[model samples]
Target: MMQSQHPPSNYQNNQQNLDDFDEVWVPNPLGQTQGPAATSGLIDIIKSGSLDSLLTNPWLVSIFVATIISVLIGAIATILAGQRSTELTPEQEAQQALLQKSQNLEQTDNNFREYLTRDDNNSGMVSNPGLLQAATLEAGARYRNRIIASLNNPQNPAYNQHEELINYNSEIEALKRINLGASGKEAQLKYVDPSTGLWVTIPIDSAELAASGLTKLNIISNSRRETTQRFDLVTVAQNIRKILSEVKAARLEALRVKGLSPVASELEKTDWFGNKASPSEAEISDYQQYKPEPIPANPNTSKQTQDKPSPKPTGGQDDK
Candidate 1:
């Protein structure tokens, strides 16, 4: 194999390469090795069409710069995307879970409200505030159960943690129950009957009801008799009715004593707890329509008027 005796001038710069030969390696696109051109050649490229032309052409320059910027931005975006994908730390995950749980709880609360609305729709008119409250509570229990069932189902949006939906603060839940008219732990509630102008007291056990979380609760009806917590609301209402009946009977007796015509035969009579506290429509109509007899003048007053007569015609002296 024959090797060159001296560096080929086309392949080397002997003058510049006085010391290191390592600096003269060149890059070629044709798959062949070459020598570095004179640095002057780069000046020519800058001054003429090679690099100068691209720099001079505004559109080409813009495209090139924009392409470089776009590539840089894309690379940065990819890195950011990767970082974001891995950014879910334990604390972040917990916060996200808590937010989702709160949303689920709020949704459950709305459902509970809807259930209360349904309870109000029932044919039974809960006339008394106590009755309305009790109904809300009964319906809240049913709503909670339904929420549990939905959460357990795979198709449910609140799936995987049904109980969390109902795990609200004790006081908050109690307030909701009361707002919805569920008798959640309230005691000594008073309601006034429209017919009778008297307030009826409702009783419940405070400590027991407060602890029951409004989900399940019972309280004494008697404020004084805390030991006897088993009185029924219906019974209380009945007693109120009886009291009202007595008041109506008293009113009827007054009318009877005044010699006023009775509105109804029943209106003139007292029937204790068995009777209604208010007059019937027919009785009310009769009372409005009937005319009472006028009171007779006192006989003694008329006799005195007669006895004091017989004054002589002395008008001038009387006037003086």
Candidate 2:
């Protein structure tokens, strides 16, 4: 094999000669040398000229940060939506339920009002008596016949016919004294005031009729006093009737709760104990025979007994 020899330059260090060299040494055109290379791939990527490209690399740290922010925003939006939905649901449901209950209550009130307005006979009056008298002579008479019939029955142990008849007769006699006339008052005399032109009626004092100006109008009559008394009596009768009606309704409700038919007057005549009797035979004979004595006129007003003093006014000045 042939060998070549070469002269050495100033940059190169010469030990002997290039006669043993196999190839020539060439200089780099870029004038760069490879030194100790970067150990990490991440450092190499950062050193690259494209900074945005390096940051957007698939395995980069910035991508993880973006993903975490997006997830947090989504979670906050979802929580806000859920809270709003929860707040509205029960309020809407309660509003709908309240409206339905109010409608039902209104319907019930209307039905009761309609029932109160029913007038069958149309005699310009309520069909049923507003006040009914129970435990009167008429009531006793109706009950006594049942007692008499029960006395005849062999099954009934507590039958006393003569005593019951006498007691019923006495009750009839006593009830005649009560003297209930009309159920309500007639319309009063209403006058329009001359100065104010308003329709009005003033209450008058029982005493000092002349000073009250009632005597000038010829309004003082037995009929007028009787009408006023009748109003008071009717009010009392209505109160009594209300009490009786409450008692009857309570009794009926109790019977219904126990799964029993309420007692019917037409079906069977029974005492409070549910034993059957005949109610039709009892007659108020004494009641039909008795008549009340006429009320005596006031002796002081009769000219024969003129010494009595008239009643004085008991009230203070009238405001009107």
Candidate 3:
């Protein structure tokens, strides 16, 4: 009865193996799960329920580690490929640049339109004088070209307008030529006749009807010449101004395309012809201020009205 009782030999060996397994793989005391691959490997080893079996099969650990490494490498490659795909190509970059330039042109056109619509008193003059001048000339050239195109096209019905413009310009040139040399002698007036649409020249002597004892005729002829002169001058000036406004918009767009800033003096300087490249402030002001003369009452119309003998009062009610 007093003899010492020892544990069974198989039980003692199993206890020793359990102790060895705990030493080889000790889990965190906090009980938090490990990474996917590591946790899975631990699960496989634990499911075997025998440390001797795991120790005997070393190929199992090799396979788990290899799988994790391959997965990590593949993930890294995918992330790198995604990043490369996001980068822009050279052709795409060029297209973006062109789109930006087109936007600039559109913006420039809008800005110029706003500028033109402002009141003359408010927008008396621009900081850059040359801009207006360059824009004006550019606009005129464009208008002339468009008119020529219309003339060339069979579908266009602006032939009359083009003819009038050319005729008016020719008359202006002719007037300038005749007036330059006549300092002592009175300059004869050359004008386009509204009735015939032909150039008509009134001789200096005929225009001076007071000396010829024909005061009324002389006055009428002189008045016609004066009115014609003013009309032609104003028409040409107005046309140029209208054209200039358009050109200015185009010039602003061009500057934007080139990525250049406008210069204050660029348009202020004269061209090869020694003429100012743009309209002067005085000229612009004159155009803005110009008011057409009210048409004079015709003597014949007034006489007819006086003689019309108040339409013999009909028997109808005056209210009706």
Clash count, one per candidate: 5, 0, 3
Per-residue C-alpha lDDT of model 3 across residues 6-122, encoded as one tens digit per residue: 976746744443333342356533454445655555576779697876666566668768999999999999999999987779887766766776676677667655554432221
Model 2 poorest 10 in a row by lDDT? 215-224
Q: Which regions of candidate 3 fall more than 4 Å away from where they truly are?
A: 1-17, 22-98, 107-251, 255-320
Model-by-model lDDT, in order? 0.46, 0.41, 0.47
- Model 3 steric clash total: 3
Best by lDDT: 3
lDDT score for residue 19 of model 2: 42
- Of the candidates shown, which would achieve the greatest TM-score relative to the real structure? 1
Residue-level lDDT of model 1, residues 102-219, one tens digit each, is 5555565454444333332233433433433453444444455566687789998767873544444333666555554444445444433223333334454655445443443222
What is the model-wide C-alpha lDDT for candidate 3?
0.47
TM-score of each: 0.22, 0.16, 0.22
Model 2 steric clash total:
0
